[model samples]
Target: MSRASARNVLLVEDDTAIATVIIAALEDEGFKIEHCTSVAARDGWLRGHAFDVMLTDVMLEDGDGLASLDSVRKAAPDMPVIVLSAQNTLDTAVRASDSDAFEYFPKPFDLDELVQAVQQACGGSGSSANLPDEPDDDGMPLVGRSQAMQSVYRMITRVLRNDLTVLVTGESGTGKELVAEAIHQLGSRRSGPFVAVNTAAIPADLIESELFGHEKGAFTGAVAQAIGKFEQANGGTLFLDEIGDMPAEAQTRLLRALQSGRIRRVGGRQEIAVDVRIVAATNRDLVPMISAGTFREDLYYRLNVVPIELPPLRDRREDIDVLCQHFLSQAVEEGLPRRQLSADALEKLRGRNWRGNVRELRNVVYRLALMARDDVIDPGSLADIIGDEQLPIGQSGDVRTSGIGQALETWLAAENPSAGSVYSQAIAAFEKPLIEHALGRTSGNQLRAAKLLGINRNTLRKRIGELGIEPDRFARPL
Candidate 1:
C-alpha cells in the first residue's frame, strides 16, 4: 500500500479517557487503530498484526511499556513509535528518546499537534535519534512541571541523540547553564567533558586565546602552551555563555571553527580537528547587537540552529513553590538547617517581581534555610530575610516604578544605544511621547502645547512634523 494508506496505528495507553480521545482523534483522521491498555495485550496483538506506527505510554497496568518496545521494534523494526507519558520529567523524556520514540508527548498535550504528528509519523521514519545508552543517574538538573518547561524538556529530548548546535536565550538567572548541562549529561556525549566558558567575563583581549589556545611563545604571558576551551571540550559540548558579548575578532575565529569543525592555535602552524557540540547562551538580545554591528549576524545564525528560549520565573510563578522546595533541599545538603515551607510564605513568594529569576529565588531560599528562627518557615521569617527589599510587584501588590533615573539606567544598560548617537536615539525615543502628551493636554493647540511644554511654538510644530504626530486627532474646537 502507498504511504497515504499507511494508517494502521497501535496505541498502548492505560488511561480510558486518554485512549478514547486518541482513538477518536485518530479515527477522525481516517486511521485504523488497534488499542490496548496493557503490554501483555499489546504483545498479544503484535504477534499477528502489522502496523505502520505505534503510540504507547510509559507506565501501563502489567509492565513498563518502554521495556516492551524491544519486541515491537523487532516485530516491525521500521515502524515509528510515539510515546506519551504523564511522568513529565527530563528523565522520562530522555528515556522515551532513548527508546527511539518518533516523538514524546507529555500529558495534557495539544490534540491538534498530536494529530499533526501522527499524520507526519505515518508517512515515514525520518527521526534522527539513535538508540544510545540511557543515563544512569536519575538526578533532576532542572525543575518545574509547567507547560513552559515541558516545551523545554521536549526540545532537550529531540537533541539528545545527535550533535546539533543549540542556542538558549533568556533573562539572567533563568538556568541557561542547567539547560546546557541537561543537554550534555543526558546526551550521547555524556561521557565527554562539558566545558563552559563565560565570554562576557573574559576580557576582549584574551577571549580569542581563551577559546582557541595560544602557543607557548605566542604572547607575553605565554609561559606555557595552554589548552583552549575547544581542545578541553573535545568530544563533548562547548557552552559559550553570554555569546552576545564575544568581541568581533573572536566571533570571526569562532564562526570559522564552527564552519570547519577545526581550529588553529594562536600563532600555531597546524590546525586541529575537534569533535565538539556547540551550545551557546545569551541573556542579552543579540538581534539588536547584530543590527548595531556589535554582534555578528552570521555567528548568530551558526549558533541558533535549535533555539530554546527559557521563561523567567516571574512568568512561571506557579513553579515558585516547587523550585523553593528543591532549593531548600539543596541548601540542607549544603549543611544549612532544614526547614518546612509554610503555605503563607509560599503565597508571599508568589508576589515578588523575581527580577533575578530562579537564581534569585534559590538565593532567597538558601538564606531562609539559614536564617529562619523557627523550624516552620513563615511569612514573618521571609519578611525578616527580605526586609525592605520586596518591591511589592507580586500578586495583588502594586508595581512601583523606580522613577525616570531608574528607567534611563535600565535602558542604558540593556540597549547601550550609544554608538555615537546616544543623544539622538534617546531624543528620538522619548521626545515623540512627551510631545504627544503635551498636545493631548492642550487639545493639540500648537501655541498652548508649546507653552505648556516650555518650548517655542515653531520648535513644537517642527518636532510634531518630524515625529509624524497628527495633533489634529487630539485637537478640539477652539
Candidate 2:
C-alpha cells in the first residue's frame, strides 16, 4: 500500500464526472495525481513531469487518446498506460492490445478493479513497456456491449501476444467458432494461414489421417499423398472444431503433437516438426466426456491451457435488440428487403428463451426480413413468425408431452442402448440436466443448490464432478 505514496498517475479523460470518480479513488489510495482533460494537455503534462503510469480514455476533447499515446510514450517510454473506452468491441480491444497498453477497460468497469490495475502497473507486477499504437480497418467483427461479451473481449486481448492453446467452450449456436476466428485474426498469428477442421464432421476412421496429413498409400483409400492440418497451418494456427468428438485413438495422437510440436503422418515413420498454434472449440460438455472416458483428460489439459468460456445468448438477453439490428443490416446487405423492428417486436423477441443463442436470432431476423408483410414489423408479426416454440404439453403440463418424453421415445427407438443399460443411460442423460437446473437456479452454489435439489451438499458436489459439470459458469460474475 505504501508503494503508491510516491507514485504518480497522469489521467487524460474529458468527462468531468468520470474524471472526478477516478481522481477520488486514486487519491484515497495515496497516489500523486495529475489530471488533464485532453490529449494536448496530457502531452504537455507528460513533457513537464515524470509519472509512473498514465490512464487515458479513447476519445478526448481535441484528439483520440489511444491514437495519440505514441507521443505520450515517446515522452515517457517507461511509463505504463491503461486505456479506458466506451467503444466496447473486439476491434477496440485489439487496438488497445496492439498498442501495448498495460490494460484496456471498457466503460462501466469496476472502480475498485481500476484502482488495483493502476497499483499493479505502478508496482511493475506486470510488464507494461510502451509500444507503437496501430489501427486496423476490419477487426470489429463480434458485436454486443453486454458485460458478458466485455469479459470475452478482455480475455481475447490477454492472449494476443502469446501462443498458448485456447479451449473455447459453449452451447451450440453460441458462436464458439467466432471466438476462434477472433483470436486467429487479431493475435500475433494473424498473418499465418488459419485452417479449421470439424472432427465431428469427419469420419472417425479417417480423423487421424485428416489431422495428421495422412501418409499416401498408408491406408486402403489413401492412394495419394495428402498433407494434414498441421502442415497446412505450419507457422500459423489450426482451429480444431468439435474437439470433443475426436476418436480416442486420435486424442492420444493429438496430445502427443501438442506436447512435442511434431506430427507423424499416417503409415509414415519419419516425424516432421511443425510450428502451429492451436485453438480448439467445442459446444459439448468436455468435462463430462472426460469423466465418461470418451475424451482424454491429458489432452484436455493440454488444449485447455487458456480456457475461454463463452456465455450463451440467453445470459445476455439485453443484447437482443442490438443483435437483431446487426442481423437486419446484414440481411439488407445481402439483398433482402429492408425491414424495421419496432420496440414491441423487440420486446417479444427478447421475451422468448433463446435456446439456440446468437445463431438462432440471426436466422429469425433474416427470415423476418424476407417474409414480413409490412416495412415496420410489430409484435403480432414477430409472434406469428416465432410461433409456439414450446412443446405440445397438456393443460396441466404433463411430463409425457414435454420434450423429455419425446427424447426418451427417440432414444429407445434409436440406440436401444441394451435392456440392461437403458436405466443407467436414461439416468445419465436426465440426471445431468437435473443437477444443472439446480446449480443454475442457485447460481452455482453447491450447498444452496444441494438444498434445492433435496440432496446432501457433498453428494451434489461429487455428482457435479462425476458428471463433468462446470458450476462456475452458472455463478454470476461479481
Candidate 3:
C-alpha cells in the first residue's frame, strides 16, 4: 500500500523487543506503526495524530490497557483497539473485549494471526461509529434473553420509530446504557449524535452547565463557549444516566426543557430550541422519591412515559451458559486460543447471584480467560480468579466452614417467614459464609471486607446485622 493509503497502527507494548518485532512485521505488511510504552504517552501521541488501529498490553507501567481502550473509543469511536496480555487470563480477555477491544491476543501470539486482525480492523469489515469497540461474537443482544429482556427489545423497537421520552429503571450494572444505545441504533435518529451524561458522576454544582450549554465567562473555568449534552444530542437521544441522583434545581430546569423543547445557555438569554429525545436511567425507586418529595412528580411522570425495567442477572440464570459462550467467542476473536467453560464451571457460574449483574460476570469471565491453564476452564480456576470468598456456594463449599447443606438447614429452621422466605433463607445461607470468609481475609476491616465481598460498606454492614454475625471473632489482632 502507498504511504498515504497505509493503515496507521498505534502499538502500545512495554517490551521493547516485542514492540520492535511487531513494528517490523506490521511495516512489512504495508502499515505505519507508532509505538508507545504507556497510556500517558499514547494519549499525547493521539492528540497529535490519528490511528486506524491500536494494539495495547493490559498491564502498562503507567495505567491499565482497559482504561486506554475506553479513552480511545471515546476520542475516536471508529478506531479499533486490540489488547495484548502476558497474563492471558479469562478475565483479561473478556474484560478487554467488553471494554470495546477489537480483539485480544495473548503474549507470544502468531504473527500471521495478529496481522490478519489488524488488516480486518483497518479494512472496516465491521466498522461503525456506534458499533461496540468489541463486537459480540455470538451476536446476542446486550442484555439477557429472558421474557423481561425480550419485552425490552420489543419496546426499544417500537420506541425507535419515534422520539419518545424513555425511562429505564434497574439495579446498577444492568446495562441501562446498552438499552439506550439499542434504541438509538434502531431509531430514526440513528444518524444523530448519541450523548450520554451521568447525573451522579458530575458535581451537583456543575450539572446545569453539563446539560445546558454555557457561554464563555459563565463560570470561573468557562474559558470558552461550551455546548452541553442537550445541544450535542439535538435530533438524537440524550441518555441521562443516574437521573435519580440529579439535584432538585437541575430536575426543575430539566423538566422545563422537556416541556418547552428549549434550553437557555447558562450565561446568555438566547433560547436554543432542540429536538431531542430524552432517555433517563436510574437504579433508585423514583416512585418513592416522588412520594418523599425529593423528586418532582411532574418530572417523574414526564420521564416515565415509556418505562422499561431491566431484570437483574440473577433472575435470568438460564442465559448464563449462552453469555459465557458469547464472551468466550469474543475472547477468541481478540486473539486468545479459543476457550470453553467446563460443565462444573458453567454450573458454578449459573448458581451465583451476580449482584453487580452482567458487568461483574463479564469481569469474572475475563479474569478466567487470562488465568485458566487449559482451554476448558474449571471451577477451581474460576474460584481462584473471582476469589474463594466470592465463588458461589456450590463451587467453593470448602472455603466456607459451614457447609451449604448446613446453612440451608439452619435458614429453613427460622420461623414465621413471608412467602419466598425459603428463597431468602437460601440466599442468606449462601452469602453468610462468603461474607465471613471475606471478613476473615480482610481481618474484619468492614471497608476491606466490603471490597472483598464486592459490595458497599453499608450494604456489607447491613448484611452482617441481618445474618446476626459479629466481626470481632474473625478479626485479626491489631
lDDT of each: 0.83, 0.82, 0.76
**Would you give me the overall lDDT of model 2?**
0.82
Candidate 3 residue-wise lDDT, 1-478, digit = tens: 3223587999988999999989988898889999989999988888889889988898888988776565776677778887777754333444553565666676667788788888889877433233334333343347444545545654664464467899999886688998888777655676789999988778888999999979999999999999999999998889999898899999999999999999998998899999998999988888888989999999999999899898888887877887888777777777756778999989988887676678767766765675466888787766654544444443445534323443444446668657888797566435765787687678889999898777899999988866645575567764
Best by TM-score: 2
Whichever of 2 and 3 has more TM-score, that candidate is 2
Q: Please, what are the lDDT tens digits per residue for candidate 1 over residues 16-100?
A: 9999999988888789989999988998888899888889999999989987888888778888889898887778888888888
Comparison by TM-score, 1 against 3, better one: 1
**Root mean square deviation (Cα) for candidate 3:** 18.7
Residue 201 of model 1, lDDT score: 74
lDDT of 1 at 175: 97
TM-score for each model: 0.79, 0.80, 0.56
**Tens digits of lDDT, candidate 2, 1-478:** 3436668999999889999999999999998899989988988898889999999999899988988877976898878889999988787887888777889899989998999999989888435433233436563568888889999999988887888999999887788888888887777777789999988778889888889987778989888989999999998889999898789999999999999999999999999999999999987788888889999999999999999988988898988988999999899999999999999888878887665579778867886786576899997666444443421222344456443454455456654477656567557546866787677678888899899989999899878867656687788843
